[model samples]
Target: MEERVWTGWNPRLTTVFSVAKTSTSLQALEAELNSSIACEIEYASVYFFMPETCKKNIPVLVKTASTPYLVVYKSGIPVLNTPILCDTLTDNGDWIVIQRRTSGDVDFFKEWVH
Candidate 1:
């Protein structure tokens, strides 16, 4: 058996990942992440408050600059097709840019992650 680590948390969500597994093949891990997202959409509704068909209508936003990973309901996405910046604060309190892939149906991912 392997150990799982809690990386981050949303108000009503918990993100658990295996430390040993994440560094090996990021693509495979991402596949696992997609599956986990799908599962959460299927079994849990405590966090997902949106309607089932809503995800299809929402646009997937990718990071355009190095910004904090804060979810803002009113922020506008960049007009260009750019990767989303996954921002994390530095030890000295600076924001660093992290790139991430946008996946899942907007409705499903939003409910599952938020």
Candidate 2:
């Protein structure tokens, strides 16, 4: 198991979002994430439409904050996998998600290069 970090934001929803791989596979991860975000964020939606083409119909503005990383995980034995942290985003740091990308059916993140 491995992990990667993605940084981005949804302006319409006004939620700062990022994604990282947990010990468990994406099968249960999506369910867990949707369930949690629905409960935690007041009006936030985790609209993941095939990473690269996330809600293209809607628009978003990228913004960065300085606190609170909302990490959600599924129930499974974490294999202590070392996640591939994107160079664009930092551990527990604030960032905006420009777009989501999937490579060979594996979801990953990419940060906007300034």
Candidate 3:
């Protein structure tokens, strides 16, 4: 038997690629991700969030020239589709912005089910 050195927990690292202003639709976005070598190698799962529309049953905005959209990946597959109000800003690739506020129009203080 050989002596073994114990190293602390080494979590598997993953990369998230964010597209700011390119994709026009979900299909387009998926195509782009499929074409990207980096995404293909790193992808495990993805979550897509789109801006909400006022119309009762309108389609969500997948990408915009001025707005930002996020694509989260894990192990190697796409897992979820949700809706968000604003764009996400990843600070120094360490933190993900879930929401940003510039006005009091939308209330942040609400119940969990709200």
Of the candidates shown, which would achieve the greatest TM-score relative to the real structure? 1
Ranking by TM-score: 1, 3, 2
**Local accuracy of candidate 2 as per-residue lDDT tens digits, 1-114:** 122222232342333222323323575888899988877663333232112122222232331345222222211227633222121245433333333465567534556762
Q: Runs in model 1 with CA error above 4 Å?
A: 1-24, 45-114
Candidate 1 lDDT over 1-114, as tens digits, reads: 122233333322422345445556787888899999998875454224322111222333432355434222222355633323323344432232444449753443455547
- Each model's backbone clash number: 5, 9, 8
Q: What tens-digit string does per-residue lDDT give for candidate 3 at 13-81? A: 111122323334677878777789667553322233432322222344344556444333321223534
The candidate with the higher TM-score, 2 or 3, is: 3
Q: Assess the local accuracy of residue 54 in candidate 2 as a C-alpha lDDT between 0 and 100.
A: 23
Error of 3 at 51 (Å): 17
Q: After superposition, how far is residue 78 of candidate 2 from its true place, in Å?
A: 39
TM-score to true structure, per model: 0.19, 0.16, 0.18
